[model samples]
Target chain A: MKLNKTSRNFKILDAFYIAMMILPIIFGIVLQVLTKPVSEGIAITGARVYFTIPMPVQDFPITESQVNSAIVMVVIFFFCLYITHGMSKKIELKRQHLAEMIVEKVDSLVKENMGEYFMGFAPFIIAIMALSAFSSLLTLFGLYPPTSDINIVGGWAVLVFFLITYYKMKCGPINYLKGFAEPVALLAPINFISEFATPVSMAFRHYGNVLSGSVISVLLGSALAGLSSMVLGNLPGFLADVPLFQMGIPAVLSIYFDVFSGCLQAFIFAMLTMMYVGGAFDLETYKQKKARKSAKNKQ
Target chain B: MELAIGIILGCCALGTGIAMIAGVGPGIGEGNAVASACEAIARQPESKSSVTTTMLMGCAIAETTGLYALVIAILLIFVAPGLLVDLLVNTMNGLK
Candidate 1:
């Protein structure tokens, strides 16, 4: 069969995309093979396998989540660099238009939530949103997603928490501290707990969602394989080993778990970060704005 | 000790199932939130985007309680049994 030039090009692209998707898993399996097994003395309880880095000084053990996160960071950095490099001033390229739209949207989102003065936060919010979304989605590529690790999400939440505290302190230390006691003094401990709970909840929300999705999908996959084995055990040779049911069912589940839940969790995390930080500044501006509007009305 | 362990596990399994009942709160809360958001949008069609965004944010926050319950349930299923047994063994050994 003779193939057209476009179809030939598409075939090459398809191969490349497939290879890109499979490369990490292949690399991981290769690494697993190459690495020396842990000694029988140390009991490893979890499902995660750690790769030991053979350093000149000492071997460093790193979890799959860390390795995957580093890979994700590098990929994002390079992709962003490549996409944004040598950009024309005019919106000639679709990439340029997309980039511009993203910037504008993020800027507006920050402005709307945090006010015009806090537009500087747009980049941070955008980065968190993108990182969270990409990390969660990385599970689709058979990688341990970064967000599945509590440390990654917790780190971002901690940053947000500090920002919230810094902004509150910037507003006024006395008022910020005093505000905790307000509406009633007895609510101070609850307020304090709630304050700490913000970051904890934010971190757990993303981590739990992604981790649960991963756990469910893995359980489903294994259950399917077990079912297949039980049902097909009597069948001869290769037919017994083939898990036919495992092919398309998990992909359907992944659409909801990996794609929908991942994106939703990412959006929620970013939105919460923005809302909490913005809210700190919004309090002062809101009061000022209200006062100004009331004065204007009276006049 | 084995019987105690079994009872502990059974109770935890039962408790975990009960904890999952918290899922109903978020389900109802989200449904109400969306219903109210839709009503708001219907009343002020121009404010649709803002209302929807707020609704989603509210839903996400409301989901926190259910997520907490889920985390607890997951821990009970995967982690708590082992830890409980370990604790029981340790206590018995210490008593010895």
Candidate 2:
């Protein structure tokens, strides 16, 4: 049999998709079997899983969400390294082409939202997008999604908030503080609340979306399993163990909750970060800063 | 005591369902926003990219109302039940 270029590419992508689906389960099973069971400080409720982390200083329990986030970080790190390991200036390799396309897309996205001066933020935006999408999609592999954990998304929002404040301070410290009281000083408290609301809303928005999806999927999965058992429990031997209702139904739901919503939430998070942080720096102030530096140099 | 507990649970379930009605406003608002965005894109095809981006940003902002309702519903369903159960236990013991 012969395949055209498009079909050949599709075949390769299909194989990659299968590998991605299977590898995580294999890893999960291996880890489960290899690790000794420690019932203490371990809990699983709906989609939220908490495990005690054996720290060197003090043992503190952390959610499985953080662990899954770390897994995603490590995977992305190695995947990027693998793709960008080799290069040919004359001829673009497949990996190089893919990497270039990703970079170009991220660059344009950042430029469009943040403008030309803030193009430096492209990498950070890309990282946030990639991490958010990957962590949320990890739910499909039966791993807890970090974004579903409020702490993880809250941390990201805090970082963005800090960046925005830092940029405002950098532009003009006194001006930044004074600007809050502008139009009317009586509205300062309201302004303060609105200012703080940005990060809070951003965090909750991502967390709520992912957590809802996780909770819904868990509910559906268990419902199916329960129905299967009620129907097939009388069957002898291995037949009783098969959750037949759960075999194919959840996959359809996963496409929306895990794949589509995950990608959309990630995009929204990145877009908000870019918009808020980019908006903090005034182009006029930046120009003034540049002009002041030039005058100092001449003197 | 069991009857009181059941009533508490039933009321919470009902309240959570009611709280989710807040979703209706955002659903309509988002539909209108998307319609306007589509209209704008149709008028100026070259500006589709920017129009879509702005529409998405507006949609996300509008989603806050729905998200708040969701948060409240989740708390009603999960967190309130345990706390309510604890309170009822304490009250029953006090009565004893």
Candidate 3:
């Protein structure tokens, strides 16, 4: 009749997981309520004219509500951190005795299976995974997901790009750059552009898709509301009916927009990051050697 | 003016909701992957570690799609273009 100790622990973990998921929703609601009414406006203070002159745009400014919405967004961002911390903790607990589950998983996989070349890649995977999850969840509760912000994603791209380049230079700068000279030096500029394009595309692709989806969703909701009011004479058929109608529609879209697409973009970003770092470190040499061996066998 | 404001506000709300559509692909793919992995593990319990590793990797890849959608949604809500007559006037006057 006695439950196993592990079973009890799992029950506790399940409870914790539920709480972690709910916390963001609760915080988002509270924050949204507290910071309602914030919106865009012209600035009276420190307004710049061209590059040199200063001019006040407006003396009276937007109400405190406008700023509150932005503040609410900031609060939601911090809430995301909590969700990430909880997930990491849960992962750590699941991999009992391993102080760092993600690190151990990647290290053993790469060292024993993939190769020592991927030794330092585990931490990056875990960090990106956690960050993506946090950012995505914020979107669920009507907050500006931080990753969508160019400044934020761009910073991540630049940081990883530079680090990869640095590692490549340290590993073998000549060999690293030589990869760009493939086929002919005439193709070097194309190679360089392609290399740089990875980060640029990664940042904008994510921003563009998510931003467009939001716009589309808002347009649909309003259109539905308008149709309901006209047809039902404000009897609120939309309250009772439109949700059910849109459910089938938006539910399908959410599958791609929210779940599948988001995860793939995160993975692509991380995978491209690994490839960039590997190139910098001349790991392509190992790949080339492998290809050469297969070619020789065929010959 | 009311109609215009309504349009703007409605767009904002609907935009946020629709932005969530980007999540569909990752959800189905990741779900299928995890399901297949679970089935595989059930069939051959010995391959649990390998299966789990692959599952996680697939899940991670699936997650990026949702993240991209989130990015776009956030931008729509926070930085969406709107017509501000006063700002438009300032901008036109070369005083912005």
DockQ (Cα-based) for each candidate: 0.56, 0.58, 0.13
lDDT of each: 0.80, 0.82, 0.59
lDDT by residue for model 3 (A19-84), tens: 665665566567556655554532111111112233487454433223323443454445344334
RMSDs, each prediction?
7.3, 6.2, 11.7
Which residue runs of candidate 1 sit more than 4 Å off their true CA positions?
A1-61, A229-237, A282-299, B39-47
Model 1 misses residue B51 by how many Å?
3.2
Runs in model 2 with CA error above 4 Å? Answer: A1-29, A32-59, A222-247, A289-299, B90-96
RMSD of 1: 7.3
TM-score of each: 0.81, 0.81, 0.53
Could you give the CAPRI-style class of model 2?
Answer: medium
Clashes of 1: 0
lDDT of 2: 0.82
Better of 1 and 3 by lDDT: 1
Candidate 1 at A71: error in angstroms?
A: 1.3
lDDT of 1 by residue, A140-256 (tens): 766668798788888999999999998777656777888799789999999999989989999888888888788788788878887888998789989898887788999999999
lDDT of 2 by residue, A249-298 (tens): 99999999889989999999999999899888888986898799999999
Cα displacement (angstroms), candidate 1, residue A293, comes to: 24
Top candidate on DockQ is 2
